[model samples]
Target: MLMNILSIGSQGGWTVAIVGYSIVFLALVCLVIVFMNLPKLLQLNLRKKLVKEGKPCAEVEDLNIEGNVNAAIAMALHMHFNQLHDEESNIITIKKVTKNYSPWSSKIYGVMNQPR
Candidate 1:
């Protein structure tokens, strides 16, 4: 069926077009799936639900402090790259994350930097 569409406008160009479109379409689908699962992938949804239910009072930073050192390291990168830089909007957007587990609290200092 899709092959027919690609075959529509040109003479054998359809094969190339079809292949290109198929690759693009597949890439897009993968992207959508990743985007949809991003929240869960980051455990953001779980954190939000827990917070709303009052079952968990701990923020991510707290968890970072308590959890494995590797997780803490990962979260550190997560914080640096994921933090919002828009001072005006004041919106912190985490890519691939759906929920806000912990509100930003005291300043976070990277390993080499002095505490803020």
Candidate 2:
């Protein structure tokens, strides 16, 4: 910043680019962190609401699923999704149709010869 060499301007192009990239990277990281914790935050909020409404603590047990149960649920979901789509043969067929050319259907002839 103190000196410019080899026709390099003191405007700090690299510095601006680096700072801009750093800001964007930091913002995206912050967004990812928020999204990663969003489900937990939502669950906590739901728990608060459920408690306020005097719902039975049994329903709260639903929110406290273990890792194994989570894995089972994920597997079940994966299986259900896999079953939802029908299998395709993945074969493509292109059929060409042939039609005889008729003089009555010729637009070029009709355009060249005008009606009297």
Candidate 3:
């Protein structure tokens, strides 16, 4: 007896539907990830642009004026961590402001803003 070769099992509609939905679900997941990370991507792109424009140590104000996102972030970090004010009035202002701020308030804000 010779075996027939033309007859074969094929997938049903339900199986095809499930596979199609799964692919769509995966694509949506990827899109969500990209959307969430879009800000960081733009920031990086802006930084490269600032560098190309020969701008260094760009601050948030500068970035804003230049319409560059990366420079704003770089400037913010610089002011927060590296920049210093030498004026006596500024020192007094910081001291007086902190003196009036409650310790609990400081603790809460500090904890909330701490780097991960």
Q: Which candidate achieves the best TM-score against the true structure? A: 2
Q: After superposition, how far is residue 74 of candidate 2 from its true place, in Å?
A: 3.7
Predicted candidate 1 versus true structure: per-residue lDDT over 5-94, tens digit per residue: 766877768678789999999999999999888755567766877788887646644543334878888989989886676348667887
Task: Estimate candidate 3's RMSD in Å.
Answer: 19.2
lDDT of 3 by residue, 1-116 (tens): 12232233453655777899999999999999999898667778888887888887364235444437768978899887754664355443334433575677676667558666
Task: List, residue by residue over 1-116, the lDDT tens digit for candidate 2.
Answer: 44545238556777887899999999999999999898788788888898899996468657777779889999999998998677788999999988899888888777778877
Alpha carbon lDDT of residue 75, candidate 1?
88
Could you say which candidate leads in lDDT?
2
Worst 10 residues of 1 by lDDT: 101-110
Give candidate 2 regions above 4 Å deviation: 1-12, 36-40, 56-62, 65-72, 87-116
TM-score winner, 1 or 2? 2
| Alpha-carbon shift of residue 16 in model 2 (angstroms) | 3.2
lDDT of 3 at 75: 85
The C-alpha local distance difference test score for the whole of candidate 1 amounts to 0.72
Weakest ten-residue segment in model 3 by summed lDDT? 1-10
Which residue pairs collide in model 3, if any? 59-75
lDDT, candidate 1, residue 82?
Answer: 63
| lDDT for residue 9 in candidate 1, whole number 0-100 | 78
